[model samples]
Target: MSAPRLTLPSPAKLNLMLHILGRREDGYHELQTIFQFLDYGDEITFAVRDDGVIRLHTEFAGVPHDSNLIVRAAKQLQEQSACPLGIDIWIEKVLPMGGGIGGGSSNAATTLLGLNHLWQLGWNEDRLAALGLSLGADVPVFVRGHAAFAEGVGEKLTPVDPEEPWYLVLVPQVSVSTAEIFSDPLLTRDTPPIKVRPVPKGNGRNDCLPVVARRYPDVRNALNLLGKFTEAKLTGTGSCVFGGFPSKAEADKVSALLTETLTGFVAKGSNISMLHRKLQSLL
Candidate 1:
């Protein structure tokens, strides 16, 4: 009999507030940021293979099969668990690449969690998160599936319950390169860290904004346009800019006005990821 396919949501995340603490000698920056999920994102489906041949049937433009994070994540889990099983993976790509929405990282996390459950490896969350960290700094938060305050290259996470607001996220017509932003000479590398609990009010700012806005007019125009309605901020090193509203109606109302000239979407912010919600349903 063919193995039953398991499909799950791979939610996108926003860095609601991003602060750069400092840079390490290894060329990594220490950061403090708050993460929250969007109810909207891509979907991934997995089918287990007994003969141990792993494959990703979906094609991501400009991303090689070996270099794809989803494939790497699945291979990592299969190798580390010493499991004689593999998976056929497919993703419905909804989130834009290099949009600063954690698209690739979320897909990797979903693969790790999905494979662990499907293959019956019985690995713990901490072990899985550690494996995820090897993929990217953002992967662990997605693996943990919590809205959190993240620090220390974004590996150290403290769960926090921030307001779940509806967001109008505008997609600028250009892709922003994270490496380019981080390497810019004018980028800020020092913002003092704050208390772990009770994040200060009016703290939603991204340090990468200045460099990104200066480099990409599309991002700047989107930010400027959105700022007319509410406080707009960039998430991570962004090609997408967002502003939060009190309700879905308010968010959609604004999105309708701006989208005539720019591409965008409205989604309710989520403290608990859809991935974890789906996992709980399986219990």
Candidate 2:
């Protein structure tokens, strides 16, 4: 095992609220969203090599090796940084794909960050984050190591510290296609814009929830189920629903029952993102 035994985490995110404001000249939606990092997520490990090879090992069967975001992210980093080492990336994926949780984007962000250190490229957070934005809108937030309020195609970020930590009853189920949700003409694109100001000290709304539930029964069911336990809301577009609890024990109890009823995970919310603190620890 001569390769650098590097391990990294790609944490899942929750959109505390999603507000769709309008459409852009680029055909992208203008929006506002509050991003929160989860305690539960996926892990990845990679060792450096000079063979110019990128490899990914996972339980996820049938994904094309070249198409895997982790591999592609590593290659992109290597190419742009002109690093001399190749990477063998290993992803221990736990987050649901296509759930609007930003799992894949987080994976890509982790790849970009982990390889920078393993390859000893010494790029700063801002540089890596800029590169990450090129990969995906969500990637930049993860790379910046913050749970943020995002706008302007989601690259613009302003980190906010939630007044208190939260408990999340996150539904894990069939992945939903973001493209489908975004392309739906029925999707809300005309919600009035609200200026971001410290999250208004309370729960906000997900503008896409109604549209998503109509198309995905799982989400509708989950929403109904979760609403009884706590005020649950849909995160991002679809496939995952979340409820906020005031206490961890209460959330855990619900999570245990939810685990039996539905396949999902319960996690704590943090004011500080694990990815940022994780990297800071290394230095």
Candidate 3:
């Protein structure tokens, strides 16, 4: 008989605010950021295999199977748990690559959480998140599946319930490399950390914006266009720019106007990731 299949949502996230506090000797930046999920993102499906043979049926044109976060996460969990089981993975890609929306990281987290359930590993969130940190700084937030305030290379997380607003997100035609943005000499490395609980309204900003805007014309154009409608902000080191609206109707109006010039979409922001909600329902 065929193995049971489980499909799950892999939600995207926005860095509501990102501040670079300093650079570490380890070459990772010391960051202070707020992370919140979007109602929209990619979807993943998994089928278990008794034999140890990890595989991803979906193909991402430029990303190799070995390098894909889904594969890496699955492998990490398998090794850590010494599980004899493997998985057949498939993804329905929707989130734009290199958009700073945490697409890859979210996928990795979903795989770890999903596999843990399927394989019956029963790892706690803290343990899974620690394993996720080895994959990427953004992975833990997705693993924890909550909106949070992050510091110290983006692994230190403190949950926060920020306003759940509707956002009009514009996707630029070009891809912005996070590495290129961080390595640039012009990028700001020191923004005094905010020391307030729940982070006061509009208390933070992305320091990478100045450098990102100067380097990617498509990103700059999208930002300029959206800024005309609302306070457009760059999420993380972005190729995507977004602005929040008080309602879905308001966000849709802005998205309609901008879609004429750029590719974009509208989604409701959430303090709790959709992935966690689904997992909870299953339990």
Candidate 4:
């Protein structure tokens, strides 16, 4: 008998330390970040079908039916393949929008990974990752399903075994536009790029903090509060910040403290992606 259809978790990511080293002539910022997969994120369920019609069951609130990343990914896959296949894409969005958490990118990555198997398309990891890179720099990490140190507009990923564990992530009530942050005249674009090396221990910093703090006071305040617990740092651009703790209980303690202070939020610890791990189990 054929294996059961797969339901995957497209995990969110925290920029443990995001640094803007410089800008390329192509207008993309060269950056460095320790990317960690979160325990919670968006979920996408897929089922193979005989008829070659793609359908989306979600309205996705503000996003259009046709323009959703899942659909876009599906079309990207179907256009390249000789096989005829259909899928039912259902997305349960747990990650916040405009939070620099790569929610949409993860969804797109999951779609690409799922359809490759469901439709029986023969593309391997490198091919899927290459396709994912064209979609977005962040998409490739989700395609690979592991934590890493990333560079080059956040595309170059080196699999990191990161003293990997629980990290207390805090998403502030305010949403920061990544484009706006990158576009700001005050953004430092020449901090000197660092080659991928050992994942630096906790003291690593995000260069965008000063720029983000000056414009978004709420983020600064959140960082201040989290600092009381551990050496807190801003993730990606701003709006969401995180601090590392040794244990889940400690992480939860910090999260509880945030509950009384900031309002809009997502507080969770680090985790490995289960999407393809489950696939491995079935295989």
Q: Cα RMSDs of all predictions? A: 0.8, 1.7, 0.9, 2.3
| Residue-level lDDT tens digits of model 4 in 1-283 | 5434778888878887777888889988888887877777788888776687788888878889888888888888888775687887777887877777888888988899888877777799899998888888999988888888888888888887676556666677787988888998988877766656666767377888889988998888988888897888887886777777777787777777786777534444444566666567756
The residue-by-residue lDDT of candidate 2 on 45-126, one tens digit each, is 8877778887786745667888877877887888988877888777777788778788889999988888888889989888
Error of 4 at 10 (Å): 1.0
RMSD of 1: 0.8
Which candidate, 2 or 4, has the higher TM-score? 2
In candidate 4, where is summed lDDT lowest over 10 consecutive residues?
Answer: 263-272
Question: What clash count goes with each model?
Answer: 0, 1, 0, 0
lDDT tens digits, residue span 1-283, model 3: 9997899999999988899989999999999999999999999999999899999999999989999999999999999999999899999999999999999999999999999998989999999999999999899999999899999999999989889999999999788899999999988887888874957597478899999999998998888989998989999899889999999999999888889979999999999999999999999
Cα lDDT listed for each candidate: 0.93, 0.80, 0.93, 0.79
| Candidates sorted by lDDT, best first | 1, 3, 2, 4
Candidate 1's TM-score? 0.98
Checking candidate 4 for backbone clashes, the offending pairs are: none
TM-score of each: 0.98, 0.94, 0.98, 0.91
